[model samples]
Each structure stands twice: as C-alpha cells, then as structure tokens.
Target: MNVRNFSVRRSVVATVAAVTALALAACSGGGSDADADKPSGPVTVKVWAWYPSFQKIVDLYNSTHTDIKIEWTNAGAGQDEYTKLQTALKAGKGAPDVVMLEFQELPTYQLTKHLVDMGKYGANDLKGQYVDWAWKQVSTGDKVYAIPVDAGPMAMLYREDLFKQYGLTIPKTWDEYKAQAEKLKTASAGKAFMTDFGGNDGGFMTGLMWQAGSKPYSYDTANPSNIGISVNDAGAKQVMTYWEGMVNSGLADTKAYGTTDFYNGLGSGKYVTYLAAGWGPGYLASVAKTTAGKWRAAPLPQWTAGGNAQGDWGGSSFAVTDQAKNPEAATKVAMEIYGAKNTDAWKIGIDEAYLFPTATPVLESDAFLKKKYDFFGGQTVNDVFVPAYKAILPFSWSPFNSYNFNQLTTGINGAIEKKTSWTAALDTAQANVTQYATQQGFKVQ
Candidate 1:
C-alpha cells in the first residue's frame, strides 16, 4: 500500500536529515509557539505538502483567483510532515491554513481535534463527484473533515516477461498464488522470488488484512473513548500465516520494497511481481526505467476466486484548518484544484503527479479512462484500477493509525527476523495498541 515513493527514499531521507529529532522533540515536548497567521490582504493561505511539482497546480489556481493567494511549502513527506504538523497543532502555533494528510492519518488528526469539519461548510454538495469510499474515508460518522483528492486502490503489478519465462499462470486466487510462488522458486533456480515479503511495510500488511476481511482496528470518533482492535483475529492470522510460510520457505523476497537493493533485485530478476497500490506503476516506471515494458497490472488475488472485494493502500486529502482566515477562499482554491474532472489541476495531478483518480469526473472522463502507457505495453492502466477503486471494501481507521504503523514496523520486522510466529507478533502488537489507545483516553475493549 506504500506509494512507490518516486525516488522519495532519497528525498524523504534527506528531509529527515533536516527535520531530525522531530519525533524525539515531540517526546521531549517542544513547540514553536507561533500562532496561525491572520493576514490583512487577499487572505494569504499557508499550505503544507511534499508533493513535487504541485506548485504547477497551485500556480494555475493563483492565476485565476486574484482575491486569495496560496503560500505553499513542501514540509517533507509522510512522517516528517505529520510530526511537524502535529507538533504545530499541539503547540497552537504555525499551523497552516490548509494541510494535506493521508487518508489513514485523517482519523488520527480528527481524534486530536486538529481538523475542521468541512461538512458544516457544505461539503455534502460535492458528493457524487468523488469516489464514495474516498469521501467516506475523510469523514467520521456523518461529519466530513477533508476533501478527497486521490486514492490508491490495491492491485498486483507483475513482470510479464518473467512470468512467461517461468511458465507461470496469472494467479486468480491466494491458493494459485502460493502454487505460483513455489513454481517460480523452483523454475527460477532460486534466482527470483515470486514477490517481495516487505515485512517492514505495515501499510502493505494492513491492506492484505483488509483484503482478507479482517477488522483489525476500530474507534468511535464520536466518543473517542470506545476502541476495538484485533490484530491477532482469525482473518489477520490467516494472512500472516500464509506470508510467514512463504517467507520462511524462501519463496518471497525478504527485502523492504522501494529500496535500491530491492530495485536491484527487480533489475536482476529477483522479484517477478509486486502487490502495489494504484500509484505504483508510475513510481515503478520512474525508478525501474530499464525494466520498462516488462510489467503489467491486474486485480489483486482474491481469497475467494472471482470476488472483486479489495483494499486501498495510500491516498491523500486536503483539509482546511479551523484557524483559516479565509475558509471560503481556501475552499475555492481546493475547488479549483480538484473540483471536477478535466480541470487544469486535476489533469496535471494525473499527468504530472501521477496520482490515481477517485474523483468521479476524471474517473468517467474518456481521456483519463482510455489513457494508455507504453510502460504497460500500451495498456490503459486506469481501466484496471477503476474497478479496484470501486471494489474497495470500506474500513474504518483507528485514531492511532500512524502510531499503529510505527509500532508495526518493529513488530512485523521482528517476526521476519526471528522467523517466529506472526500471530504472536500480532498479539504483542494488539496489546500494545490497546495500551496506547487507553493511554490516549480511549476505552479499549
């Protein structure tokens, strides 16, 4: 479920260098004490994001809307951004007018009361224009908090050339996938793995759990006190058990994905396929350029054959803060960027940023739907994801998602390193999560 990161390992690592000790600082309890800006002219809005080339879209919006100006900053990506923003929110200082958070992080922010309820500002009118699942993600219960911008429905990205060479059948179910893993392990003479294990990727494992019908975590945001978490539940146990076997048997590559070593494996025929998110193809193509035209994407293997039920990986949304000086104009800027299909910003978002669309207008647009890529052998890749986005079975994110993922990195990696039972790791993780939730004032069951 990780975005292919688009060379972000190099970039985000650099960001961490500059934003060093943010989490440590949070632990030590520090903040800038800077208040949110209240501008006198044109309602200057400070926006924070790490998306490269997003200024192009911002520029377009600024050109047409002279009454409001966007002051944008690339505040690093993922954890760094979240750390800085959360620190600001907690400190009541330097919070931007608008912020971008991953869908998973939305609930975490909401739990802390950091986001504004956009529904009161008339977000419901924007319904039917965005994907239902995505719109649902930014909301807790009946209150909307953010505008859905992009989605990352799960799909399988495979090396067609490698599959053909190995005489492997495209797997349609988990059983077939295991058989293919064994077949590929034998056929490649231990030179290639069927796919990567990536035990460090909690998002990927969470997506797998979603696909397996696992309700691992839930918290009632309305109350913020009632929480339910079951990482060792039967469904999750089934998924982890399967992967533990594959990894133990040496059928799956045990390397973390989106790394130089992993890409080297791909180039060297070490991994033939990857279960990646919708944003995967572009990121993979950017980094794995030499492997161009060798890959193809398909629906993820289902637990039940032919079932289209699925899970989402990574995606982001735009939220106006409760401290905005011009919430209406901020909404306008958001409307300009992602209001409808074929807008300049949305076009650039898909073409330049390579974010897969969950907005209806773009989803139904002929150009977007029929867009073909030479990287995919001229296949219209969006055609493959449209259904995946639609098929995503809805799931609720616990308010402790970032916390859960951060802990999971350690727990899951330990499982892989020790070659121990993932079920036991889940038990530990579940217990820790419950403890953390309770510490955060949630009533855990």
Candidate 2:
C-alpha cells in the first residue's frame, strides 16, 4: 500500500531513546531466574516495536522471566521499521533479537531471508492456534517465519446522524456508494461528503483489489517458479478507476491527511464515511472525544452486486530473531501475549486505545461483539467486522512491494490532479509498476 511514503515523525526520537534506555537498564538487572533448570545467566534480547502498547507486553514478559530480559526499541512507523531493520540486517550488528513485522511485509522479509525460520525453534507446535490466513503470511516453503499478533478486518464507519439527515440509504454496491456520495455532497454543499480520499495511501487500492480476487503476486507452492502478477489486472484497474472517479466527481476529498489529520477529520465531521477496519471505531473514539454517539458501523460496499469478498488493510506479526540468546523463551513470551485466553485483555486494551486483536477467539467473543460503543450510536461494531476476518483472500507480497505501489499511486494522483482520464492514469500506473517490478527482479506477467 505504497509503504515507502509511510514514516514515523522525528518528534518520536526522544521517546524511542528513553524506551531504549529503560530496556538497557532492565538488561543490567540479573534477577532470580524463573526457569531454574535453564541457564541462569543474564540474556538481553533486543526487540523492535512501532507501538507503545507492546511495551506493556514487554513489561509483562520481564516480570515473568528472570534469565531473559527484553530490550524494547521503537522502530518508528511501518516503512521506517522495515528500513531500519533492513539497514540493521545489512550492518549485521545492531539488529533487534525480535522484530514486529506487518503482514504485508512478511513475505518481503521471508523472501530476502532477513528473518529467522521459527520452525527451527519449535514454531510449528504453536501454528494451530492462529487463523489460516494469518499463519500463511509468515510462512514460505514450509518455513514459519513469524507469529501473528493482530489482524485488521475491514468494515465501514459512517456518520449515523448525517445519513439520517440526508435520507441516504446505506449503500450495498460501489455504484450505490458513489451515488450516495454525490447526494451527500449535494446535500451538504461541499462541507460534508463521503470520505477523505487518502491519495497517498494505496491501502484502499490493495483492499479493493483483494476483494476483487486479485493479488500483487501469487506463487504456487507446488511450483516455486510460477509467480503470478496482478498489478495491472482488470480488478486492479477497476478499483483504481473507482477511486479516480470519486476524486474527479468532487464527491471525495483528495487531501493527503496524515494519521492525526485522518482521525481529526472524522471527529470534526469533515468526512461522513470511512472505509476502515474493526480498529477504526476504537481509533475514532479515542480521538473524537466530543463526537460520541454520532458514528455507526456498516458493511463495506461490494464491488459486484452481491459479492461477499472481504480484504484486510493492516495487521502485524511478531518474530523471534536469530540473534536472540534465548530464542525459545522469546517465542514463548510472544505466544503468551497473542494467545486466545488473552483475547479479553487485548479487546479491553483495544477498546481503550484502538489496538485490534488478531486472536480469533477474541473477535468471536460475545463480550467483544456485544459491547455498545457510544461513539457509533451504540452499534455492535464487532459484529460487522468479525466475519470479514475469514473472508479475506490470501496473497503473497513481494519485498519490493512498497516501491511498486508507491510509484503507481504517485502516477495515479498526478493524473487526478491534472484532470487526466482515469483509464490513461491507470495505464500509466500499470507501466510504472511493471518497470519497477522488473527492475526489482520480479517477473511481471
């Protein structure tokens, strides 16, 4: 999803340094070993995480174990995290003993052999606990590279009051969604419309493509050489065209809203609809303090008239690095944090901070599904997204993913800004993706 443009700001540098210092201090402490049979020597395992909540999990691990202490380092945002990890791997020295990887980037890391094969450390024993799709992302050629920590199941967030005010029906198809957007724009006179088109983020495009049964690359396990490319495929073109039309018709705002602006825009009623995942409502609730009870959840508008395909936008996995001194202990700690029993705790944390859980049990829990989110007009938000978890198609992502997607998005956005034809823009995007993939040594068919 144009991962190259995603980055953590420089302001977080101080926070990262402080966290790293705390971790280093913990490493210095050689407390009573939890596993007396195992080696009691102090082992400091460096871990890289992009979010603050993971620090809590690290603390939990430290409290439970004495021999192995984890050093938590903030790796910035998704793209920044990958860049730093790549640099560390190349340098062969400062890389963390554990790295938090996004699902989209798992294949990239696996393909480049940047990550350790977890199966070597008994990861297969724990494979049964995770969902199939989640597990598939971290696997390559029978080698399980990582353990999934979270999943982002797509759903729709809308302004309930605005829908009622405009007398607009909840859309069931993309065409209906577009027509509603037009009506909403006309009704509100440009002050309110459908949603903010995140021109800079290709995540929407990716989700749409997956829902259309396409992937950036498809590799047949039976034949490793058979890699399939869906970059310029019909489904991709249709999705891009849909976005282009939205931008051109004045129903969508083409402003490049960063993370903060995105949440703020929803809170301030700058946008009436948000095509998002289960975590979106929680995120909006956290920031939209004043707009409580004004929002609601709905199903994503289908591309085909009655299609039920679903797709994910963002998710993450945890992997123990080969450099770790206590790899077994580290894997155990990761499993404990992501296990099903902890789903309630994870859901509570998500409710407090918008951190979605990947554990299947948590998503299906009645407590999670029944909770009435005041921000969403007391709608049962979880019910809308849980089903999408199983409906998403599995795809193999390439290491050069960010490069190709970012280039395609830039070209498409440029065309939109210049009032170029949608088809022409898509043709340019296809050519750009093809060239980029070829340059990266991926066979673009």
Candidate 3:
C-alpha cells in the first residue's frame, strides 16, 4: 500500500489570497447541481484512488456485479490528488464519480459541497459494521459523507533491546515518559535521543495534540460559514510545551519526518522509540530491516495516569462526488469497495497491503488479533493497537485544514530553529488560522 507514503501524507497549501478566492467561488457556484450526465445502461462509476492493489479489488467487484462497474484510476496520492480535486471543483467539471479522501481532508471538500451525503444511499444502515470512531470521522450529526476504509490508531513502538539495556520499563503516564526519556539520554551517554519530534509534520503533531485531549477545531455543513478555532487550547499548549522542553534539552531530536535522515536514524539506532500508529509496524519493518526482532509495540503513555485516551494519525475513505453521473451506483461502490462483506477485497487490503481494518468483523477477528510479526519478535501487535483504536475520542476537523496545517508547519519550524517557543508557536497558529478562516468568510467562534 506504500503505507510509509500514506503515513506521511502532506498538506497542499494554497496562498491565503488564492484559497479565500477559491472558497468563495466553491461556496457559491460548484457542486450543488443534480447529476447532468446520467447514463442509460449499466453504470460505469469512475473512481480516483491510490489504494494498493486496487485493480484486483475492482476486478473482483466487476466479476460479481452486473449492474455497475468500477473504473479505477490512481490520479495521485495525498497532496497531488488534493490539488487536482480542488482544481476540478473550481472548474465545475472533470471530477470522478468518487474519490479517496483522508479523514482530515474530508471536511475541506464537504465545506465546498463537493461531496455527496452517502446517508441518502443507505450508508447509515451500515454503521454497525465499522468502528465508532472511524464512522464518526466520515460523519457529522446525521450526515454520512463517506465510507470508512482503514484507520491508524496510535501506539508507542520502541526498541525492546534498548529498553532492557537502559534498565527501563514501559511508561504508563506522560510524566513517566519524560523521566524515561531523560534516563535513556543519560544511559546512552548522549549517543541517542529517545525519539524525534517531527517539526515539519503537522499531522503527527496534530495526533500528539489529539492524544492530549486538545479540541483545536470545529465546523459543520449546517453552519458552513461558522468555525470554532482553539489551536492554542490548554491541552495543545501542554503537548507543545512538553515536546519543546525535550527538544531543547536534547532529550528528543527535532528531525523532519519522512526524510532520509529520520529513516536512517531509526535504522542506525539513533532513536530508541518511535511514537507511531497502527500501520507503523509494517512501515518500520520495511525501512529498519536490520532492527527486526529488537522492536516491540506498547500502549501510548497516558496524559493523566491510568487514562486510556488515544489518537489517530492517518486513515482514508471513499466519498461519492457530487459530480457523479449515478449517485446511487457511486455510493454503492464507495460503501462496498472495502466493506466487511467483501472478504476478497479485504484479503488484498489487509493481508497483502497491510491496511488496518475499520470494519469490526475484520478488526475483531481472531485471525487479525492473534497474528504475530517477526519484526516485533512474534508479538501480537494488534493487541496494543485495537485498544488504542477503540479508545480514541471523537475529533472535529476545520474546513480550512490546508491552511491550518501550513500555519502549524511554519510555527513548528520556527520553534525547532530556536526562533520561538512551542507555546508561542501554537498561539501563533491559533491566531493565523482564525484570521484565515475569517478571511475565507467563516465566522470564527
């Protein structure tokens, strides 16, 4: 699935002037019309996605369904695809029947009314099949915008050998985690930092803020022009301050993630722990092959002692675009493309592509939970991830996610370069996002 690339999905930020203009254009003139090119025969639903082995899944679907067929295309992944989708929306044409969208990016399209409400096509009836948090991600109140496909539940991936060598134990709380980071630095004689705080990755930083119970944004289609912004909330400040101290003291490195330096650090034993998500094991296995049996997965440290709150890093879904020639057929394709009922499709997704399932049947299957990995010395890593997945609290994303992430990336880079404090960085993000939202015609709450 190119899971590593998926894990490091980057934002495609437009300039404030361009974005504001696009928002105004999209809000007034795009995607609100009925399907204009309905076909007379068996429907061919055009789909844009980058899911691994998608052709096999499409073939399976085509072989069984006589009334509808999927015409799949990998337009691009993440930022590349988003840029194209935005352009298509602005032009009021050239969009596919359906498109794969990451959870965080869904709201941006929804704000422009470019995505269809799958609830009208019976998606609400399938809610019980998916994990609650995953369902929540594609829904707002009673509207279902997409179908849950996969999820990235957060956990701590550490070097077991290093933990033992440093006489350390898995931490149960963030305070204890900090103490252990300090201990690891001293024990390694400053040869290694505990982990890296990825300054350039807004998604990773957002996941950390989520784990700490930050409520950074709120927006809904019912009130598309109103948004609630609190990027500098107490929880966010606490998380940022915590990492800031660690980075400043050299207890944690501030390396940009997805770069060769960070990957090399993982393989070279320069980092003792990796705060990762459900798909992290596969990514680590692919990159740090030399550290095979030395790695192990564990629950993330709690902010409050004994708490089990968790956060997600990356996950995506299929949404029927408002430009679909046949909304019903497109909705069916979106809902069933990776559904629990499609075991053949899931075989390619889970077994071969290493996707973490959102469907409960697959997520809770004995085979999934009991499967062990040679990379983690045969540990049933799902045991750590399943709980993390189930424990995540509901989170709301802003419609201006691209600009929000850009602001965060700028602030984090400034902090990493010693030009500002992390707390100041977040405060700056809060101010910048609020102003941007207002500029885009949103009433900041």
How would the candidate models be sorted by lDDT, starting from the highest? 3, 1, 2
Q: Pick the candidate with the highest TM-score.
A: 3
lDDT per residue (tens digit) for residues 50-74 in model 3: 8877888889999999989898888
lDDT of 2 by residue, 1-445 (tens): 1122233211233333332233223323332222245456867777887654666766766776776787888877775776677656545567777888877666555544445666766778766666787778777656777877766778778888888988788999989999999898888888886988766666655776777776667753233223466576777777778888888788887776456777677778878888876567766676677888888888888987988888877777787654555666667655665566765447545665465666667767777778787777778888888778777777667544565456556766687788886567666766765665454444544
Clashes of each: 2, 1, 0
TM-score of each: 0.90, 0.85, 0.94
CA lDDT scores, all candidates in order: 0.74, 0.67, 0.83
Once fitted onto the true fold, the runs of candidate 3 whose alpha carbons sit more than 4 angstroms away are: 1-3, 6-10, 15-20, 24-40
Q: Which ten residues in a row have the lowest lDDT in candidate 3?
A: 1-10
> 241 in model 2: Cα distance from truth in Å?
1.7
> Which is the winner by TM-score between candidate 1 and candidate 3?
3
| Model 1 per-residue lDDT at 312 | 79
Residue lDDT tens for model 1, 1-445: 2345523312222222222223223333332212445456776778887665788977877787767888998887777676678667756777887888878777666655656666766777787787667778887666878888888888888999989999998999989999999999899888889988777666778888888888887655676657788877888888888888888898888787767888887766788988888887777787778888888988899889878878877788888765566666666555456667436777787777778877878887887888887888888888888888888877878765656776666777898888778888888988887776665556678
User: Between 1 and 2, whose lDDT is larger?
Assistant: 1
